[model samples]
Target: MAFLELKNIYKSYFLGKEEFPVLKGINLDFELGDFVSILGESGGGKSTLMNIIGGLDRAFSGEVLLAGQKLNHSKEASLNKYRRETIGYIYQSYNLIPHLNVLDNVALALDMTTLTASERKKRALDLLEQVGLQDHVKKYPKQLSGGQKQRVAIARALASDPQVIIADEPTGALDSQNTEEVLALLNKIAAEGRLVITVTHSQHVADSGTRIVRLADGKIISDQRLKPAYNAKVESKLQSRKLPLVTSMRNAFKHFKYHFKRNLLIIIGTAVGLFSVITFNGLGTGVKGYVNEQINSLVNPKQVLVTPYVKSSNNNQRSSYVNLTAGDKTVNTFSNKDIAALKQVKNVTKVEKIHTLSNVATSFNKKSTNITTVTNWTSVLNASSIKKGRLPKTGEIVIDKKNIAKSLTNNPNSLIGKTITLTYTGLNKSGQKATITIKVKVVGLTESSGSSQINAIGGNTIENALKAANMSTDVAALGVSASSMNTAKKVAKNINKLKVSGKLRFTATAVSSMLDRIETYISLITNVLAGIAGISLLVSALMIIVTMYMSVSDRTKEIGILRALGESKRDIRRLFTSESILLGIFSATFATIIALAVQSLANSALSQIAHYSFIQISLSNIISAFIISIVISLLAAILPARHAASLNPIDALAGE
Candidate 1:
């Protein structure tokens, strides 16, 4: 029984409905250790017969038997296994992957073996050494001469220890000297217990082999035996399996690195979109914080400003004029009953009487200025804002130096112990308006801390001055203070819920309320900006798709070579997808780095103004950016990878 047999083979081609026969009935027998050369002219079906024998052309009607076992041409998996485990092909063009070096080109054929990484490297090295190209292992195909590239191709074909080697015009492009060397190498491979098949038109080349089979117009004309076949066993202990995912990833990374500059640009472009998204989110958080800092620091955060609910009477002045007896909207004041009810609320640690004396004539050293102060001393005033002196006593007042500085003196501290008088119209005990004057000593000078501050005086002094003028001493507003800032919000909520005869009587406002309002606006604007930046991400995804498609086009021959090495279509798809995902990972990682850098620089530059960070990139923000990048890239790669895997191995090999 023959080691390999081709029985009555027939093949043809078709264009529309026209059939063109390429190979006539062909019967041949190939044995181990036989260096058989198929001698024929161009287009005589020598190469087509080699394709069938190598299990690369499955569209033929024939029986290919190895040890009397017939090859299953109808099933692709069986053909792939036969090609991988038994047949090795050497093309005339060398078909080396341009991006890979000599050593990697050989090692790639061993990807389906169960060998460890180090073992695979060792085997590749051994193979390169065997081919006498050990010194050129690191060189690319373009860097090597014709003979060297052919030697590398031969070494790659032998890497998997295939049972048969099919060389289609193996020395077609080589010089006479290189051709002799390659033919001698083929004879040596046959002597090492493997069938070596070479297709050639040169009689000299055919005469060098152990047997010459001449074909004319797809029909064998003659078969001549030149020498007896050598005898040896062809077997290796190497176990084989399907290609692993790690191999695909490693190959993907190799391609990624080979095109580093182009991929880097893509990654940077992608990072721009990711950076914008992260930065805008951080900006929103920072702006809210800065606004809160300014507002909360102005007064005690635990203070809620409570005022008597003013009615529509202030607008309807004519109606007030008609109902005028002693009560009016101008003196809308909080009664003792209101203050008592506030102190009863939870978390209400303290409450103080507050008076707002607007449009009062304040005089100091023959200089007069308008006064708008909550004149009564209360906890609502941030004590840390006092520049000098202390809170006022019974006959003393604390003046805002920033507001009345020009009206008083160049140095306001000098006027701290000086006398100041305020004149305002007030209702007397008899319910008639009268002019009142209050003489008070300026004990302290305070500055505005990012928020409005008023000129303040002791509440007792104001009440006594009104009493001296025989005017009604009415309380205007109350300062509701809580135990903590958070408690202050709760206290304000409770206060607003208070009503008189089921009518809303008072409204309270806390520092957090103002902060929340400003923050809401900032958040809305930031989200809008971030959303707009997200469109750039879509553009980046499209760029990845284009890049992947270009990659598929560029590596078409490499794809065919890998398929000939028995790599499954699924492996090819994963190979391309792996590169895209790596692009996403690297892009997201670089974006995070950029975000951190911008955050630090922004915070440092603005430290002097608000002493706060205005851009705060969070961990979640980075994670979300990575997710978006990966998902987009993975989706972008799908069509291109599928197209690459769906390619015909024969056509791909023929592609330029």
Candidate 2:
């Protein structure tokens, strides 16, 4: 039996309602080790016949039998397998990939096999050497001559070691010397027990083969045998194999390297968005650290601030709770019952009542200024913030550094021991507003390093002054003391549950807890800002998608080449997605580096004023940025990758 048999093949094409018949009732038989040429003129259906035999055209009516098994064109996978293992196609136009070098183009077919990289190269090099083009292996197709390009195409065709070699106008583009060389190579392939079929319109080319069949008007008119068929020396077959995923990634990287400049722009664009997210998060962290440090220094960590939880219009704002006067009748103020409940809170060592006087007048010599005073016997006043003698004592006051240094005297120390006058107006013992004055000495001056409550008069002196004015010194809030800082947090939580008249009358908070709240607020703001930065990432993703789509358009021929080399549709998609992932990795890495450098520079510039580093990029932030960039890149490439993979191999190869 013949190795390949085509029985009564019929093929046609339609132009609207008109029928254009190309091939009709064609019968042919080909044996192994026979060099046969199908000769025909233009539009003689010769190319169509070759396409059918090569498994490239399945829209036909016939039974194609190979080695006594019927070939089913309806099953794409089976046809692909047959084409990969049995036939090799050499087009007249060379059809070499523009971006690849001679060696890679030849090794394209071997890439679909299970051979190792070194072995694939060895096989490709041997084939190139056989065609006398071994020295040009590294040169691209555009850099080669017409004959050299054809030689590379021939090498690529024979790379898979198939049993059938299909040559369509193989030597049409070569010079006389190169043409003879290619024809002689085809004759040698037939002598090695393989079928070599040539399709051409030239009589001289057909005469070189052992058998010649002439076609006219879709019918074979003459069949001549120039030489007897040679006996088979050995049967050869291409092994069935799947291309490894790592090999696909490596090939994708090579393509990336070829287009480095274009892809670098994409990476930089994506990195800018990632850098924004990372830097903003770092800035939030640094600011939180600075605020916590300042807070810890100003207030004693073991003290908890207890205030009346007067319900406010907005939950986020601090309620307006102040010290009660003699005639005041407000119920929102902390009552005696609330204070007694806080004193009972476990771990509470002592409870100190605090008083605040608003809009008071102070004078030293002829200079006077309005000041807000707090009864400052609390533990929050750090000794390091005092710039003068000591804490306020009875009949003496501590003043603000800036106020005393600039308003009353040029030097804060000069104001110490100096007599100062204080005046107050409020409801007196007669239930009417009255004024009173008292004389006091300035004992200390406090710098602006502490809170507003820290710069004030002694609580004992303030109580005495209020008594003299016939005004009430009802406590504003209580300061609860605990054995330790950790104890304070637990005591505050217990005290916060206290209530009066079935209403939440007091709220308790430690300095550490306040710092935690501030940090939480900062975190919320940072995430919101990062969310805004992520919008730019979406734009970058869009840029990537557009870029990949453009790549699909530009590399259509390359896609076709891979498909023809026996790559599955999945492999094509992997190729494009792998490129996108590489871009993501590159962009994320560069973005992290840029963000760290920015953080370092920002801290250096701010250290002069802040006395501490103010920008910190944590490891978690770096990891999140990387994951976001890569995931976005992969998502952006999905549609474009699927589009490239779904393209028909025949149409892609024919694309310009």
In terms of lDDT, the best-performing candidate is 1
Per-residue alpha-carbon lDDT of candidate 1 for residues 206-297, written as tens digits (9 for 90 to 100): 88889999998889999999998879877856777888998899999999999999999999999999999999999998888777765653
Best candidate according to TM-score? 1
Poorest 10 consecutive residues by lDDT, candidate 1: 316-325
Scored against the true structure, residue 464 in model 2 reaches a CA lDDT of 75
| TM-scores of the candidates in the order shown | 0.83, 0.81
Which residue segments of model 2 deviate by more than 4 Å? 232-238, 299-304, 309-320, 323-328, 331-337, 345-352, 355-474, 481-497, 500-504, 509-528
CA RMSD (A), model 2 = 5.1
- lDDT measured at residue 269 in model 2 versus the true structure, 0 to 100: 91
Error of 1 at 359 (Å): 5.2
Model 1 alpha-carbon miss at residue 304, Å: 5.1
Could you give candidate 2's per-residue lDDT for residues 1-656 as a string of tens digits?
A: 99999999999989999989999889999998999999999899998898889887889999899998999999877877887788887878888887789999998888777677899899999999998899999999899998888888888988999888899999888888888888898898889888999999888899888999999889889889999877875465447576677877888888888999999999999999999999999989888987876776566778888876755558655454544544334435556777777777789888877766667787777888877764555665555556667877777777777754468777667888888887877776678997768677778777663335345666577777778777776665778888898888898878777656676666777887888899999999998998899898999999999999999999997787777667777888999998998899899999999999998898899877767778889999999998998899899989999999999777887787
Cα lDDT for residue 392, candidate 1: 78
